[model samples]
Target: MAENASLLVELLTEELPPKALRQLGDAFAQGLVAELRAQGFASPDAPYTAYASPRRLAVLVKEVAAQAPDREIVVKGPSVKAGLDADGRPTPALLGFARKQGVAVEALERMQDGKHEVFAYRRSERGARLAEFLTGALEAALKRLPIPKMMRWGAGDAEFVRPVRGFVALHGEAVVPCSVLGLAAGRSTLGHRFLSTGPIELVRADDYEAVLEREGKVIASFERRLERIKQGLAAAAGDAQIAADEALYTEVTALVEWPAVYEGHFDAGFLEVPQECLMLTMRQNQKYFPLVGRDGRLLNRFLLVSNMQVDDPAEIVHGNERVLRARLSDAKFFYDQDRKQPLQSLVPQLAQVVYHNKLGSQLQRVERIEALASAIAGLLNADRSLAARAARLAKADLLTGMVGEFPELQGIMGQYYARHDGEPETVAAAIEAHYRPRFAGDALPGDAVGDSVALADKLDTLIGIWGIGLAPTGDKDPFALRRAALGVLRILVEHELPLDVVELLQAAHRQFPAGTLAEATVGEVHAFMLDRLRSYLRERGFKADEIEAVLAHQPTRIDDLVPRLEAVQRFRALPEADSLAAANKRIRNILKKAEVVERAPKAELMREAAEQALFDTLLSLGPQIENHMQDRRYTEALSTLAGARNAVDRFFDEVMVMTEDAAVRDNRLALLAALDRLMNRVADISRLAA
Candidate 1:
């Protein structure tokens, strides 16, 4: 097999945030592959490599075929009713279909599989060359690929993350000609914004790496950029260690066309503030990387990379320092001002800020949070006073100037203010930890008080939105309800807090119903909680049927649901579990047969040996099944059902269940019915994957 050729693409644009780069990179790669496959490109595999910087998004494909493979197509034509006339002559419909198919009218043939007459035809056509279709299709796909956010430049219609300044498209040495969003296809691409000289001509797809390298651009791969960023930051920090925030590093690497390391310092006095405040202010506000001493204490120094290289390093350092100074000053002012007032003082200010137009004010949300958290604390056996204190101040930061500018600092500032106000350590910790693991892979709440507050906050958000019918509709969950739901699951799972989620919902709803916030009722809120839980658990590696099964048990506590699900999943893995599932299905089938006559066998009249065996097995296993399920030994319960398999198969094999005597038939049916109840305690075996 000869090595397949490659195609290269580069969409040069203005600087983009590091966060947006991956999203755009993914969109382009996925869209290109999907389009090529759709256009019938079938020459081995065309794997893609993508690289992004602040200015350009680039991709290089490998092993793409020179041409598409010829494919056979089966086109379904008009039905016999529409294709045939009374005289059986080729009707206008048949002629029209042939014309639409690009086949001659005489080529039409009637295909028959069985009794039904159907109009079908098979045609083979030579596929268009890969280059030709790829060129056109790639151009079209690039224009339509969805970016999370886009901007219009040049003309109002020209919209992308940024202006489309240049495009590089090549298949082997040949330039694939097409245009998108006003940019014409070319082999020319701009390299690193400042480091590279000018627009460089990509002689061929294979030369992409060499050209960028020679031009002082690091475009071959992301590994090089990541290495340089990591090495440079570490070298600059020396004894002052620069710990990489995985997320922050990724965002910064994507935001720069050519990353150049720079370090700056703020007044040491700022270290007096909490590390969370300084880190948040630095990373969120200035996009500067933070540094720490060997002892893991916050160092007053910070490091950042500039996308552009400056002639004067000292000037660049001074400029960045100025920005840091202003930000740290503002942070200091907010911290000091917040300390002067007690945590209780901010409680009244929350009323002025509306949480949601329909959901009332933040004060009302705090009220809801307080009540729910207090109730949840009681359920979890936490200190109710601490839970209520934490909940009341959770949203107070929304009114803070610091949080207003940096919404990500909501909980961080609350914790700071709580501690500054000399609130109990538990309450302060809860304030900060309540929003733990705000997103996927985020940390779970650390303590009982924190867990309770976390649960209450997410529950309030979920129930409040659900009550108003403003629940996440499809993929449009603007409220991040999905995250809220996941947070609820994480808090429950990590804390292992035995909870009745429904009871919690009822408690929360009772405290903060539509009347409480002009929203809805407890019943409506409960339904929404169920929806959020379904979506949440499904995301956390639970199958839909597994969720349905465990949720059917409706364990009130998240702790109960987790183990029950773990048990169900454990049972699902066993060999006998499948056999038991098969038996249940067979039993249901037997019951179905008796359904039409509306009569079932009775055990009293079951004289057959197999029927007697099945009845005895069910009778013996009934209490064992109940005991295992009561102990939450779903796996054991499923194991117990394994006993019914041979007995069930034997009964089906020898006995005629639908007998003349309704009493005998119903009695046998009752035994099978008992088996279903036991098996279903583990899972609705009928819904298990076959």
Candidate 2:
């Protein structure tokens, strides 16, 4: 056996979905590396790299040691009571223990420790060969690695994300022996399907990558494939700009075993369609890159990446051209059909389609959005008429032919269709922006109209679902309420728009049909939105509990969240705030101890000057805190909270709050309650870190 042998394996299958393959490649590499380390066979220079293609998934590791380290083994025998004889020497129990440990009674030595006599021995063995151990681990990983969706091919019932056709496993110059899902491992792998048909025998681990490359394939690393794809694309489209979508390029790279760039063209007449439509149609549907002319107009030509390097490139180009023609023709048809009717005509049809089984039809949802949008516009002092118009048509595109075919183009198609129907420009824009910030880090709407509609749409969805008792449970958020809530917060905070989410929810709750969701029982829903807000703040570098404390006291204004969060962050770093929190904790601890035997007092009968002083200070800060919060001066508000800390400490030191006098104790307790209320206004300072 080679002492420092390493292994390389390749699984060549049919074209895999790009997104699926990227995820699969990452998961396979991580799992393999962990399994190698777990078996105690790690080498300093050894690491795994994964490369994916539409036709194959490959993993390579270098300079692996041939054997794991050998180590001493210790075995413990039965207790002294079971092993010792009358003379404290060998007995039947000791003999049985020795036999179990593969050591004879004569080989065993009795050692008397503090409490009992024990028998111990050391055993040593050579580590398993790398080639053998790797084969077992590889097989285990192949079977255990999760694929989002899988298929069962041929017989033997072995399921995989995609069908497995060929597998090549090489350890140095020899093949590794392992079988997975009924397929035996070998050194033979095919390349480029039709372009290269012969079996490529991987004789050496290092030579495997070269073999695939020589056979018109780029199989060694995803980075290499990405680099080649980008360079090839740039070269194909010279001076004329052909901006490659990074997301699309990543997906295209994952979809091919051997990427061959070729140019194709469509009749320039298709460019008459809006640029968004043409681009979405080509890039999203056919995965083709559209070209631009010197003037930045959509050109007649496009670029296509193929897995196969055909002898006749023109034929492949023609085939792709035909497919794109059908797609573009379908898009043109939808565009023309949508233009036949006024965009408003579709608004009535939405009522027939159910938004949810329990929560009325789409028309009802539109009504809720309209009401919610108007309220939001009023709150933000935006163009209420424009917001109402935007909300009415926000979901109108759901009934459009193009959007029905491509659900992702819901709001986008609405904007295009609304524009064609001669609606106001702001309305059309809002129609598109209603779904802003669809994912984290995505852009929110820049216009007030879009912002208002976005708020209304998300709030309506959240309130409607929560009102109906259909709130998200655990991981199953079918309504995407969590995402909707995050989008609302992003639009409000990122745009610095003033929106009272609580009041907006209340207004929306009123618009629901007679039995819409029960408005009163959505505390969990409110809690859910606050949790999302806290998470958003935490992601932006605020501490989790700090965000929670700020959100706990007030979660209505998304605009208020920023300064409050900023204050909490700055306050968290201060030594005085930490000291105050610790001091409050001590006072609460004392109060809790007293509560065990006696009740606390209210504020009216406080005789101690410290108690009265603390109450007066708390009262004085109440209006200041409200004013600071109103002005978004949260640092000032927190400082106002700091003003009462000394008074609280003095009151705790000088006065016994839990006195036997019922009225006096009640009054003292009321003072603490008032203090708690005031402190909570700035933030739950009680929740601050020490």
Query: Which candidate comes out best when scored by lDDT?
Result: 2
lDDT per residue as tens, model 2, 1-690: 466666676777777777777777776766676667666666644677776777777777776666777866767677667777778777887888888887787676556666876777667777777656866776667766766667988866877778888877777777767665577888888876666768877778877668888874555567787788888888999876775568988898887767789999898888877766787888988899988888877887889888777677999999999999999998888888878887788889988999988888998889888877877888778899999999998888888887787788888888888888888999999999899878878888878878889988988888888878887889999989999989988887888877676766677777776665774745666678777887788789988777767776666777777787788778766656876676556655654664432433345577889988987787688899889877878898887777776787788789887788877776776667556656667677667755
Worst 10-residue lDDT window, candidate 1: 595-604
lDDT of 1 by residue, 1-690 (tens): 122477777777887666767777777777787676665553336577776666777777776666677788878777777788898777787888888888886677777747666676788878777645755676666776666677888644877877878888787887777666677788877776667778787777988877787775654455577678888898999988775577788787876656789888889999887777788878877778899898988898899888776777888888999988988888888877767777688889888888888888989988989988998889778899999999988887777777776787888888878887888999998998888877778888788889889999988887777766666777898888777777776677666777877677677677654364434445565565567778777877999888887777544566666677777788778766676666767777886776533333356677999988877787788899899878877677777777777877787789886788877767766766666666777667766647
Looking at model 1, residue 221 earns an lDDT score of 58
* TM-score against native, each model: 0.80, 0.84
Models, CA RMSD each: 5.2, 4.4
Q: Which candidate leads the pack in TM-score?
A: 2
Task: Give candidate 2's root-mean-square deviation (CA, Å).
Answer: 4.4
